[model samples]
Target: MPDLRLSRRRVLALSAVATLLPRSGLGQTSKVARIGLVQSTTGGSAALYGTEQKQAIELAFNEITKARTLGDIALQAFHADDGADRGQTVNIFQRLIRQDKVVAILGPTLSNSAFAADPLAQQAGIPVIASSNTAPNLTKIGDFIFRTSVPEDQVFPTVLAYGVRKHGVKRVALIYGIDDALTRSAHDVQKKAVDALGLESVGIETYQRGDVDFSAQLTKIKAQKPDAIILGALAEEGAAILRQARQLNLDPKTVFIGCNANISAKLFELAGPAADGILVGASWFAGYDTPRSKAFVEAYRKRYGTTPDIYAAQGYDAAYLIAEAIRRAGTATDSRAIRDKLAGITDFEGVLGRFGWSPERDATVTPKVLIGDGQAKVFAAAPAV
Candidate 1:
């Protein structure tokens, strides 16, 4: 709820000329690195995730830039609120390129916006990394576009396979938002995983983005008596589905599993007891015990006064990856050099896991977790095999 805009002083301080010059007596010239963040904040429903996304980006940028003497490569963040409008995202991306002269771009959060903004950034030759957008087309946009989030094709199979192999799930009812590209992609992947595992997709239903009533969908799903319900949507819609399912007295004696996006504190708060036993695939959970994750969670809490979400961890990892690229490139101005360095990066320890980018594999395989009852457990890992 705080003012999301950058302050005038911060803006002036981050400008190209001011950042490139050495401090009055430090005798150390700094490289001013401008990064533009284009995201949605417009629709009533879209605003739900905007504040959290912005806060995560700010927290990561703050942690990465603190006490650093990257001379002249002083990082600066500029934000543009696209309000989930496709046209607005395109316009903002162009303005940042022409006016702000940002070297890189990060996020429009949703894949719909990314689908619109990424092509523009690619055409302009700016390296763009997404924090949460996971449309499969995003990876194909250009070599210049990268994403910290796992692709749905990769993530859903892991979740589904785990459910079928480990949890003995035989039948699942999938409920998703057809309008959102990311959710649709997740559902498609879920179907493929179900078929491959020989588990029945008993009932499949779709909803719009802002529909508060899911009685109709839940009613049909309840009749099928599925072994579990798989949610392929954001937290808000997932919460609504669970709440409706409970109200319909259709509580099956089956476990509920959802994609990574459903593993959030807000989902629990929104659905109350209905969210109690829902299991979700997650990239990073606050309860993780890894030293790197512990340090990040502690630092983030101290700075933001709250536990960070998976998106925050992704944002942190993205910034660290960019910083490492800069360090390897040895020059902040050479974008191509940075890109090449990023591609060649290997054995780079990260909060999520070790990342090694090869020309053959554009995606980074990170560890995943499961969350329930406000606690996170390491369920399984994608082994190097």
Candidate 2:
């Protein structure tokens, strides 16, 4: 990977200022700092994702506190459950930034919520490290906006290319939730890839996030008999669509391809056997073969009595990112220093393995495809490229 650290000239400038200033940047300053963790803990199906993310964040923070990850500076997390409502997200973000005076924020869970609340943080010039917003142009929102989630632009084309080659997919259809920003953005990426691959566009369908019935959409898709139905939705929403499609017998031969959105327990629990035979590409897998990843999985299972999914992994790594940035910046209260440190990160080994930032401040990360097996409530390696 190319080095994404700041240029030597910028580093020299910062160093010069550090020499003139008296103890404010890194190790010289020690103060308590507040961080906002905004996620949807209540609003319907979204809690499936937000809950895991929240749990993982807490877990990571607990470990960091025990380890004194920030040295003399103490970090306090202010958790808020936005209920997956855009209005509530904005309100929570405002409170966190203004009243609580947090230096940084972790999330609002969904990309829809991110789009809704990120601007507030940008306006205030606070750093926002999102854990699970995968839509395109998310980091482009501003310099303060960064995400650990791999965008759909990077994830879809590769997954689709593999699916088409391995499964002989000739015709494709897209079913997405139009109400949510993440799914809408994913729909755009999937459509572009379909056209690029020269696949026939069979049927396109849209739904809201909480809708339970997809019979109408499934019936229309069944008529086209596309080889694959690409889903651009969160776990619960996608599960409902898949279960409904199976009930309609939407061509048993037709398989499903999903983005990171479907790689969660919600899909396994809600869709049951229907989740099997689906292809999914995600930035993190619970069974990833890395020492750090294995330890994380083992610890999570022992604590929660259940395996953590991609969202949990993202949240866990995000917490580590926050603490590491504060340590590098040498001040928990300096948001700009934290932001620069995050952008300058050359390598960070976490549950996601080695990680860094792109020039645009998006995560410079690679994704792997995992196949769903109905019997195991978890994803396994795709077994092939």
> For model 2, how does the per-residue alpha-carbon lDDT over 30-66 read when each residue is reduced to its tens digit?
6766788887777876788888888888778767766
Most lDDT-accurate candidate? 2
Q: Which residue pairs show collisions in model 2? A: 26-330
lDDT on C-alpha atoms for all candidate structures = 0.70, 0.82
Q: What local lDDT score does residue 157 receive in model 1, on the 0 to 100 scale?
A: 77
Worst 10 residues of 2 by lDDT: 2-11
lDDT of 1 at 371: 41
Stretch of 10 with least lDDT, candidate 1: 376-385
Q: For residue 347, what is the lDDT in candidate 1? A: 75
